[model samples]
Target: MIRVTAALSRARAGLMLALQAGLAAGLAWFVAHDLFGRPMPFFAPIAAVIALGSSVGQRLRRTTELVIGVAAGIGLGDGIILLIGAGPVQIGVIVLLAVLLATAAGGGAALIVQSASSAVLVATLTSTTGQPWTRFLDAIVGGGIALVVMTVLLPLNPLTVVRRAADPALRAFTGGLHDAARGLADADAGEVRAAVERLRAAEGTFAAFSAAIDAARENVAFAPARWRARGALAQYVDGAAQLTYALRNVRVLLRRAETALNDREPIPGVLPVSVRHLGDAVELLRQEWDRGVEPLAARERALRAVAESGRAYREGVGYSGGVVVAQTRTAVADLLRATGVEYAEATRRVRQAIGWTARPHKARRRSGRPGSMPS
Candidate 1:
């Protein structure tokens, strides 16, 4: 059943691709015939490739930028052509001017190269008789049509895109959190290193999604939904940070505990409890933040387990182990305090970031407007 479903999904995607291609071809043909009087040789194909290669969000941005670039290019190109007359020298001057203008406009180096190439193409192709302005307009119209078709017919929904991205990001963070917790319990250096690497990979994924969110926000069609998704992602990031800190401190405590256990010294009773509590806190934060499911009961249970474990460890320590026990106890106490503070802050920040009303002041500052405040 799963195989069949996957096959059907692939078929549907293929059909959509075909439909978009056909529509773009048709529109391109119509525009070329109507505007140029003679059909364009390969312009439509080029435009279609650009449209298909770009995401809906990026296509919109690039189109806006291209339009502005073309408009400036045409005005500058025409002025140079008129002043210098149609000669090899005039075309060379137009190319130089186009490159300079594109560079000055902060269009990036590649764009300046493209702009210069486009200017040379226009000058060469229309040197004999055709109007440079008209040709420029035709190219712009083709690109614009391609943009519209891509935006309207086969629109990539930002909400769907972000939601898809969020799943992998959440999984990565959750897996790293669990691995880090287990690594602390075992005092395994290799596992700890692996967990840190996984967290870093997850961080990279979050950064990419954040960039996508920013791009989507600039899109008039997807802005509101993208903003909402961005808010949700910010919550997940905060939760991940909390989980990370808790795991780090727990890992340190476990290392200390291992040293005491190996030295045949009395284990500090509070040490085990602190490690367990920190691990529980991380797990609870992951569940609550990622799934939006309240796990307060689970958290309470974990806290109790930690407390009991700490009591047991303390009771086992004898006078012979007094020095190690005291040292470990002090370290555990400090870690517990730090973890508790971090967990609380993470919870508060996650709430605000996710649009929950639990932290109004922070939410207000994040609202992107001046002091209107978030209810």
Candidate 2:
């Protein structure tokens, strides 16, 4: 059932992309063939499809690369074939030269691949290697049509894209925290190890969120209709790094928790409770983000987690347990920052909640980096 629902959602998203690609290809063919009267303008539709296939983000840059690569490869192949004549050796030399030149120009994967592919097509397919600027012009028309279709005609909703990408990441983060809590409460090292593995597997989800943010930014920038999403997107922009850090810190916390359980360290009940509270805060933050509301509840819950972690610390823990407390403090600060709090303010709030008030004569121990683990 879950797999079916996910498939349906993906199909819905892909439908828009398919429609955009079809419209761009058709328009490019019409412009290149009917208007420009170019004979058999197959390169036009091919360029359009290739540009769109690059990625959902960076449409303009990808289109530009596609057109330039096609033009350069075609020009190079034609000039070389005119000089050396078309044969296996000539085709190999032209493709090699095109690839080297594209690489030297610092072109991306699409540009480099398209350059070699275009050179091969020109060397093998064309009988007479005269000036083939018509193919280059066809490429330009195709790329321009792709840009228009992606940005102006069929831009995705920025908010929808962001939320859809964020859902899996946030769920994984929250679920990992809950699993860690359960492991700590049960004093089960194996369960906490399982949680660590789950968190590690979420790297792909994190990458997806990063890509979605870039795509959403592009949508809001080029599509005037998506301008209203700019305000909502600001939170995601601010929180992205902090959320990544929080996820990392929680993984570290769970690892230390597993160590503590394995070593028979004193695991306080409040420790697991605090972890559960952190998980609750994460879920609340996602809910608030989807509803476009202020995440006051999440902040409150994170602060409470900090207070509980402090209580657990004072309950007299062993070395690994103490490490867990320190990590919890750092994770709480990161969660606060993820809720749009400023750095200094979030640090101060976390310190206050964890009973770390400064004293004139007493020196406090410095906290280590958030996600670093002891060897």
Candidate 3:
């Protein structure tokens, strides 16, 4: 029964993909044959399907490439097939030529596949049906219509798209910090190790968020309709980058924490509590990003958290404890830098607020690098 249910669920997951691909293919075909009067232009719908099937983050760039790939494939195949005549050898040559052309043009997997497939169609099929450059024309038609359908016909709010993508990564990062703090508070080496593992896994989220930022940038650049969002999107990208930097440092902190736990170091509970405060700052960062709310209070809260943790450290922690505390200070500095503060100024702000006095032996500003993301 469980197996049957799982299979059904998996199948259901494909429903949207099927719907999107089918509709795109149908519309592409209609535009190519009905509107453009391209006779039996089979490559048109294929281009549209490929465009719509690409991942959400960079659909604009991918669609443009797909259109170019289709044209490149058709032109190469048609020219080669006409010159050499249709045969298995001609088919191989056409494919090689298409691949070389697409690769030389800096096309990715989608373009390469489209080029190869389009070449195959031209070489194997009868020349009477797909005249010289007819498939290329069809590709133009399909690709243009696909862009129209994507951008104008069924437009999504650009900010909404970026926010949706960013939320998952942000949540993963915040949750990891929370769990790490909990483990630290409990002095559980095992729990710290687990938190570290989760933080490591969130690297994929980091990459995804980075991609989403680039996608949002591209979306805003190309779509005049989303021009008003440009400033907000820039701020969001900076914040997301800072968040990624903080998470990376958090991973290192968690590892050290695990080691400290194993060595039976007396990690002050105040330290973990401060980590929880940073987590709150992360939540507030999300609110600021999504709703354009003020983050000044959240920033103050985070600084206070770090300062309190610092005061506890000044009372005299051991070597490992001091290292962790320094890391926290750096992390705090990173968060501040993400708010568009200059590097030195951010350092000054964090140090002044946290009352971090430089020791003769230790290097200053080792908490974390400038967080250029969070604003």
Candidate 4:
């Protein structure tokens, strides 16, 4: 059932992209063939398709690269054919020159590949008598049409794209946090280990989130229709790095938890409860963000988690258990920061929750050792 749902979701996204690509290709062909009067303008549609790449974030860059690559390849091929004549040997030489030149120009993989492929096509397909810039102009028209199709005609909803990408990653992280909490409650090392593995496996989901943010930001920046989403996207941009930190901190918390269980450390009841509270906080934050509301409840939950972790520590814990408590406090701090709290304020809140109050004289002391200063 899950596989079927995933396939359907993928197909829907694919259909949308295909529609855009098809529209861009058709428009490019019409412009090149009718306006430019270039009979059989095959390169036009080809360039359009290449520019409208599958990766949402790369369309603009790919379009620019495609135009430049086409120009370079066509010019090099034409110049080489005029000197050496078109043949098997000429094709190889043209490809080599195109690849080398693109590489020297610090072009990406797409640019280099496009350059070589265009050179090969020009060398084998077109006559030397054709104008050198004819296909280059066709490439420009195709790429231009693709950009217009992507940014102006069929711009994706920035908020929708971001939500789709973020939900899966956030859900996976929340699930992992819950699993770790369960492991702590039950004193099951195996469960904690499994949760660790689950989080590690979610790297791809996090990568997708990053890419989605990039695409959404680009849409907000360029697509006038998507400009309204900029305010919503600001939360995502502000929280992205902090969210990553929070996930990492949770992973560390789980590992410490597993270690504490394996070593037969006495687990405090508040430990598992605190972790569960943090998981709840994360879910609440997501829900509130979707509803376009302040994450006040989520922040309160996270602060409570930190306070409970401190109480757990004050109740007396073994070395590994102490580390677990410490990690819980830090993780909640990261969550607080993810809610757009400034770093210093978040740190102060976490410290206050953890029952740490720095004395002014302690700050003046030159102490480099860990925990050397009074709090």
Count of backbone clashes, every candidate in sequence = 2, 0, 7, 0
Estimated TM-score for each candidate: 0.53, 0.87, 0.81, 0.86
Order of candidate numbers by TM-score, starting with the best: 2, 4, 3, 1
Which residue runs of candidate 4 sit more than 4 Å off their true CA positions? 1-8, 78-82, 124-129, 355-375
RMSD of every prediction = 11.1, 3.6, 5.2, 3.5
Candidate 2: pairs in clash: none
- lDDT by residue (1-375, candidate 1, tens digit) is 999999998776456446666677667667767655744524444445444444443435565555445445555666677667777898888888898888777885445655676666656654444544555565566566666665555544444444445556546655664664465456454665676577666666665555455444444253342344554454433333333343344334444444444555554445444444444554454455455454464345344434443354326653323332223233223323323434444333333322344545766467443112221
Question: Considering summed lDDT, which 10 consecutive residues are worst modelled in model 4?
Answer: 366-375
**Candidate 4 lDDT by residue in tens digits, 1-375:** 999999999999777678888999999999999988998778888777877764465435655787678767876887889888999999999999999999999988888988898889888988887666777778778878888888889877778788888888888888888998998899999999999999998778888888888878787788998888899888887787788888888888888889989999888899998988998999888887787677899899999998887777557667777777767777887888889898888878877777676645456256333222322
TM-score of 3: 0.81
Candidate-wise lDDT, in order: 0.50, 0.82, 0.73, 0.81
Candidate 4 Cα deviation (angstroms), residue 110: 2.3
Compared with the true structure, the alpha-carbon lDDT of candidate 1 equals 0.50
Better-scoring candidate (TM-score), 2 or 3: 2
lDDT for predicted candidate 4 compared with the true structure: 0.81
lDDT of 3: 0.73
- Residue 358's lDDT within candidate 1 is 53
